[model samples]
Target: MNKPQIRAHGLLDLLRLVAAWLFYSSTIFFHGSYLSPLLVHGYPEAGSLAIYGYMGVNLFFLISGFVIAWSAEGRNWTEFAAARFARLYPGFLVCMTASFVVQTLAANPTLPYDPSTWAANLFIVAPAFNRPFVDGVYWSIVLEIVFYGWVAIALFFGVFSRWKLQLGAAWLLMSVLNESVVHSTALQMVFITQYAPYFAGGIIAQHIVAKGSSTEALLLLAAAFLLSCKEVTAGADWMQAHFGFSPPLSSLLAANVIVYALFGGALLLRRRIAPTPLVLVLGGLTYPLYLLHQKIGTLWLNALSPAVGRWVALAIVLTALLSASFVISFFIEKPIRKPLISLLLPRLNMMASKLRLDRPA
Candidate 1:
């Protein structure tokens, strides 16, 4: 394979970060005012410009798949899992803790903390098991975990080696049936279709990287899809009507694909663009912004909306979110990432060695 060509997608990732901030800020702005035109009841955009952010999450998953495959190509699956846990869990736990603390302080007197419920969030499994949307953004994290677990399982069963195409094909079929399966039992119906593409796209992108493919055209297409795609309104009745198949499934699939493509395109761009310190720094802050902003936004909306104009409140919240996310990313997230991985990797290796020795194989 030829040396991978670096593109300008890093810059695009930074731009996406800025876009997410604007979307979220708009959500807060619109939601705070009953008269705000953007606030349509039941539409996700009613709360924030998260229709865009949802695509961004798809991009994140694709990036994860691409980066993980590229980074851990020949490594043990356990190490990859550990790396992901270290990358995501610590920040998640911290943010969840902060959310609970704020909730305890700010909620109506009648609202009480349920330790059992809180315990579920600490493990990041609550959202997966039909639990309430704690901190709102946690649902995506749960999905991310599910995606990772499926990938790990695929790797374990040697499905990845024997039939990569078959794996994707199977997932696509399940995704097609996702809506129907939801009726039987949402718990057992793990349709891999909705998510497999993002990861698969990442894997494909990695191959492109390895082959030194030019990504300019692909990147442009992704940008167009991301910016121009239709958004689902907060309380869309279209899904309720169900036109033969679920429109929810169609829309969800579309949204996920658009986002995945955008990220794949971004990867090509990341290498082509000149490295800039500021852009890189902002891009790095995305995870913390993602993890912390929901709680921060909720708290800010509750505490500050009364005193300031809706627009002004929105500005303040956006500023605080970006500022705090950067602080956490640089000071907390970045620092701990390396040490946590370093600490965990050795213990995992030791356990793996012990298990190997204990077993005949």
Candidate 2:
């Protein structure tokens, strides 16, 4: 029964930075191919921390749901669609291009761009074209797009204006079925079934935090956490099947518990932090950091290891990659988003106006 109260939230923004740092350190420090040369020399295996780091994507989905719901207040379906597009696509295009260029040049890159795969990935859903993502990290982007699509549909139908909790609860129930019962690839693809709990968690968080607290939101929040806990076991099975190795189930469970705690605890303390521009910018850096950190950071490590020694190389590379992401967030993404919104919002408003269902009752 609660409506979204959109506002700038500093604590949530800072938590996003934490998730980004977790994933970034896991990627760069663990020394996969981008880092193997340095890692092979002496870096310790991140072990359980690396496994836990995988759940950072879950945190991202949760935060995104919260952000979208908050941002959706007072906006028409068309305007919502435009804002989401401008927020994501321009930076994605630039980062993908940069990733492609870097991967092509790296000696042992994982995301070598085949023209077809690269082209398909430009849209963030290469699977739709029957191709793999240009980089492994892209699967999250696909899930995000799918989430946006469903929300946009709700907007089109004009129900999202008043039905946020009902829709979130419904999605959470379906996600529970998808995780516990029949495992359907179709369900997973369209509904983002495996990851729905996290998204639902964000939605629940939004309802609780933005609209003031309520019992319904609390119960759904508990359900979402339980479902996410279930995913830890499933994720272990997945890793074993594909990668020929699996971390201990206890380790996986512990990691999930820790992340859910961190995320949930942070949300609980949202008002304790001040909403500052620097914190907000740190939040903005997460997207570019996520995009740039993986293969590129590793590539830098590989190139630098013998010349600088692994540890020193890691320090330099981490500093540089983090700075690059900061620069992209501050200069590229921010500057472009403002102009893009001005140009696109009017057109989207027109499109949504034509949809009879989109009109407010």
Query: Which candidate comes out best when scored by lDDT?
Result: 2
After superposing candidate 1 on the true structure, give the runs of residues whose Cα lies further than 4 Å from its correct spot.
1-56, 108-114, 127-133, 156-166, 179-192, 211-261, 356-361
lDDT of 1 by residue, 211-237 (tens): 454464245334323322322321134
Off by over 4 Å in 2: 1-9, 29-42, 45-48, 107-115, 243-245, 354-358
**What C-alpha lDDT, on a 0 to 100 scale, does residue 279 get in candidate 1?**
74
- Top TM-score: which candidate number? 2
lDDT of 2 by residue, 1-361 (tens): 1322423446667778778876676655443522334344545555545545567777778778777777776776677778899889987888877877777766444444578867888778877888766556777887888888888888777787578789888998888787778788899889988888888888778777767778887888888888888887888887788557777888777787877887877776666766678778878888987887766766777678889988888899778877888888778888888789889977766665675445641
Please state the error at residue 352 of candidate 1 in Å: 2.9
In TM-score terms, candidate 2 sits at: 0.89
- Candidate 1: worst-modelled 10 consecutive residues by lDDT: 227-236
Cα shift from native, residue 64, model 1 (Å): 3.8
Looking at candidate 1, what is the lDDT of residue 71? 48
Clashing pairs in 2: 34-298
